[model samples]
Target: MSAKIQSSNKKGLFTKFLDVIEVVGNKLPHPVTLFAIFSLAVVIISAMAAAAGTTVDFDRVDMATGETELTTVVAISLLTAEGIRRIFSEAVTNFTGFAPLGTVLVAMLGVGVAEGTGLVQAALRKLVLATPKKLITAVVIFAGIMSNVASDAGYVVLVPLGALIFLSFGRHPLAGLAAAFAGVSGGFSANLIVGTIDPLLGGISQQAAQMYSPGYTVDPTANWYFMIVSTFVITIIGTIITEKIVEPRLGAYTGGEKASIEKVSDHETKGLKWAGISLLGLLLVMLALTLPANAVLRSDSGSLMSGSAFMAGLVPIIALFFLVPGIAYGMAAGTVKSDKDIAGFMGKAMSTMGGYLVLAFVASQFVAYFNWSNLGTILAVKGADVLQATGMTGIPMLIGFILVSGFINLFIGSASAKWAIMAPIFVPMLMRLGYSPEFTQIAYRIGDSTTNIISPLMSYFAVIIAFAQKYDKKTGIGTLISTMIPYSLVFLAAWIILFVAWFALGLPLGPGAYIRL
Candidate 1:
């Protein structure tokens, strides 16, 4: 009785904490409205800052000449006439040109076909059924960790599928969703294979490193080894958290009949077989294009990771890959009789994106306004100056950097964009203190990725909320954030400890990268 009382007391405290988060978060307006408010705030703040002559000057390295030059970033007041005119004129383009807008829509088209024909559902069912009962949570978490290879596609595909898989096993769907989201967003920077972000952030770090060492180049594979190790670290941590904390708190499956497991029929099994064959064929074709010395996917220099057509076109390639297999499954299942069915599937997918489209428009405007105001850059510069003044060095300093980066990540959603602004400052500062840009970059990544699952500003955060609402209508930003706080906090701590250990041991971060300069 006393043991049960202690457990109940712990549960009560946790529930109270979550209640506080929900109340505070719910007090805020809708996400769309919040973005609009942020946009307006940026404009007002920009005008005030410009009036006060706010500006930052930093040295920049010229890529072409390998020379250092001074550049100044003055606050740009969006309240000005030209700014107002530009904002009005560019609103349409901003909405249409948003990065997530196009990629998500294109990918969903193919996913829609697979889902509509029962292909995706059958495949997920098979995946879960094939896994040992004891390892279901681990499998979901591992799949989520690996899904980063396709970028944001994981948020769209794997997260909801995880929930469905858990539900079919008479488990709490939200716990499954949390576990997957933790892996996809929280473990984003950890992958066994080099991802699009490796090149993107590498390019930014190279530019920053050039300021201190002319003609310096940061390889895209700079963090590959560390991240490869991190993949397992995050998987193990995520699995443990899901099984011990999240699932227990969520308790047993209480959702209605829709959540029950249903056996796959013969037709769906046939569809899965056809889809598997089609997927294998696609893999063979991709290999044929990439493996040969003179293949089209290979760079002129014969490298697959850098300056390659394959790396550049991965998103579209993934879309087409899914499209073909989806169509094959649909046809095998007799759900698609003609090309019209395919078109319909794509159209239906696009239609469901209406809310996201609206959110994207407002979000794009806010992001643009923030950039135009130069506030993010100025804040980064000031933050760097403060860190530099601290006189801290070694692992402690890097841990401090990680904390700063995580805090900033709550406001800035885009990894590459934040890194672009931060690298020009932190990378050079760290280099002067006997650290390599690669090491600094990894520190930044640890902070950036761990907080993503909780940040409302993250591009797909809204979509995750929508996914959650399917299970519980009352699901809000707080519900997700509160649940994910454990993952974020634990991941941050574990990753930092790993980084410090690697640093102390003088281990190489990658093949050609080290912690110390």
Candidate 2:
């Protein structure tokens, strides 16, 4: 009895800690406002650093000449007359030229159509419903991971479906919800296919990488290979946690309502079949364009993956990859009756991105100013020097970076927003330490993803709590975080181990992306 009381007290303290985190996180400013503030702060700091004559010298490789030269970066004050004029002149271009803005918008145009047409939702339901009862946990988790392809569809669709499916099987509904949440949120960075986040983060990393190497390009597929492997690893781990830990801990379902799993309607099934056919047809067309040595999509060197027309047009290709199948799905399902419907869907998608547009505008100015001031370059060099001086190079330093990223994730829920701010510092810093931007980006992603489930600041966290309350009236922030903490802890450990093993084996993070420069 005494021991039980002691354990209860410990749990109570842990709950209170999470409650504090929620309060603090909630009190923070909106992400867009935060970026605006960051932009202003950068302007002020640039002036201060310039006044103080802060500078750094580093060896820069001349891309055109293939020669290394010592380059000195002196902080430029944004408050100066020339700086103020440049900022005013470049403001419009900063927003327009931002890499992530166009790529994410283009990609979402297609995803929005697919999602708007109900194809993504139907596909997720079909995947989870088709799995055998014994393998349902793994399937639910896998479905959640794959649902990232359609943005927030997993949170809105699969999460609650997971609960209903579990209740249908006479299992605890919360266990299924936990499993889905684990995959949707905790395993966010792990997906078999490239998603909107891939390009969004890649663009940010590329922008940051350019601070160190002018011609360096980080492709959307930079972390594709690692993410594909992580997908299976997370699935297995999530399944194990769901079955061996979370489910058992919940004991049994005592909820009032009995719910059955919703089966896909006939039209949706037919739509999926047509969508699959269209997808295959699209693949065949792509193969025809890239298979031959003299193919139109091939590079001058006859490479398809590197410096090729196909590689350069990847964003449009990805857009079409979804657009074609989505159109087909919609037609067969009667969700789309005319070309006007497709246009309307696309417009609706862009309309929903108003908040993102505002955030991107401010963020781009911040990035441009940081670059213009030479602050990012100087910081990278100084940071690298300090790390090298301390001899913290290699796996230990990488692990520490990941931990810091995870800790920051608790307060800031937007992955792209956080990366935009962090990449300018960490990407170039890691590059100076002899790591590739791709490696740094993937490391950041791992940390960012692992802590998402327990973060109250996550955009979908409130939605999750609302979902939980349907089953348990007492479900609150503490209860949800406590349930998810096990998944978060296990995923962080397992993912870091995987990252270390990958590093040790000298594996390619993605096509043409290596561990070192």
Per-model TM against the reference: 0.71, 0.98
lDDT of model 1 at position 163: 89
Tell me how far the alpha carbon of residue 427 in candidate 2 is from the true structure, in angstroms, after superposition: 0.8
For model 2 the local lDDT of residue 41 reads 90
Please write out the lDDT profile of model 2 over residues 1-517, one tens digit for every residue. 9999999999989978888888898898998889889889989999999999999988886645657788888999999999999999999999999999999999988988998899998998888778899999999999999889777889999999899888888899999999999989898999998888999999999999999889888888999999999999999999999999899989988879688766899999999999999999999999999999999999999998878998788888888988999999999999999999999999999999998999999999999998999889989999999999999989999999999999989999999999999999999998888899999998999999999999988999999999989999999888898899999999999999999999999999998899998
Stretches of candidate 1 off by over 4 Å are 1-13, 63-66, 144-229, 240-260, 300-303, 392-489, 499-517
List of clashing residue pairs for candidate 1: none
lDDT of each: 0.79, 0.92
Backbone clashes per model, in order? 0, 0
The ten-residue window of minimal lDDT in model 2 covers 59-68
RMSD of each: 6.0, 1.1
Which 10 successive residues of model 1 have the least lDDT summed?
A: 21-30
